[model samples]
Target: MTPIERKLRIFVVEDEALVAMLMEDILLDLGHEVSAIASRLHQACEIAQAGAFDLAILDVNLDGKPSYPIAKTLRERGIPFAFATGYGGMGLEQPFTDVPTLAKPYVSEDVQRLIMGLMPSIP
Candidate 1:
């Protein structure tokens, strides 16, 4: 018998349009659905609070504003997420040190691997 794979509904929070688009493409190629995208801190916060997603990929900064508020909201909702940043994991503050991070300029395999690791039920 084989296990069935479930597609994940992912929320993306990124300020840069190009980066966001790239992430969307990567996720799609990885067989995941992007539930929503938020390019600003406030919008991201709102989406984090209201959206139903299996997981999220959040940028550490959104147009010079930190994204901790969105992270907090996701945490409150019990949704697991990873940080994507140009500065790698170092871009995250001390409080977020334990979260997984995908460095900037990542490849599709990196994104796929990270997502698979985060959500083991997905194949």
Candidate 2:
């Protein structure tokens, strides 16, 4: 299957309820499954540790705290992920500066691009 045709299990970490729902909706509309949603740093970290999904989109700030720890966990587990932020990838620190990013207020096309970025060989 091609990247557009593959169904990914996506984990979403966003503090804002509406944004989380939006991400989930976009993922669903793209024919992917939302494996889980985390709205806080601690919860998101736990989910990242479990690493249950094929890919993830992480909000940069969760309840005023950075989601870097969750990003670290995802990296350690080797699960592909992208940062979702209004500020874009400039907020990222060392070792994660180059990870894919999905800007805020996303639509289906942005989500599709994110999917392709994370899994270029998704077949």
Each prediction's TM-score versus the true structure: 0.91, 0.92
Compose the digit string of candidate 1's lDDT tens values, residues 1-123.
112167889999998898999999988877789999999988888889989889999999888888998888887788888999889886578678888999888988888877877885322
Candidate 1 C-alpha RMSD relative to the actual structure:
3.2
Give candidate 2 misplaced runs (Cα > 4 Å). Answer: 1-3, 121-123
**Residue-by-residue lDDT tens digits, candidate 2, 1-123:** 234657889999999999998888888878899999999998888888876689888999898998889989988888888999999788788888998888877788888877977886332
Error of 2 at 89 (Å): 1.3
**Taking the candidates one at a time, how many backbone clashes does each contain?**
0, 0
Q: Distance from true position, residue 108, model 1, in Å?
A: 0.6
Residue 99 of model 1: what lDDT? 87
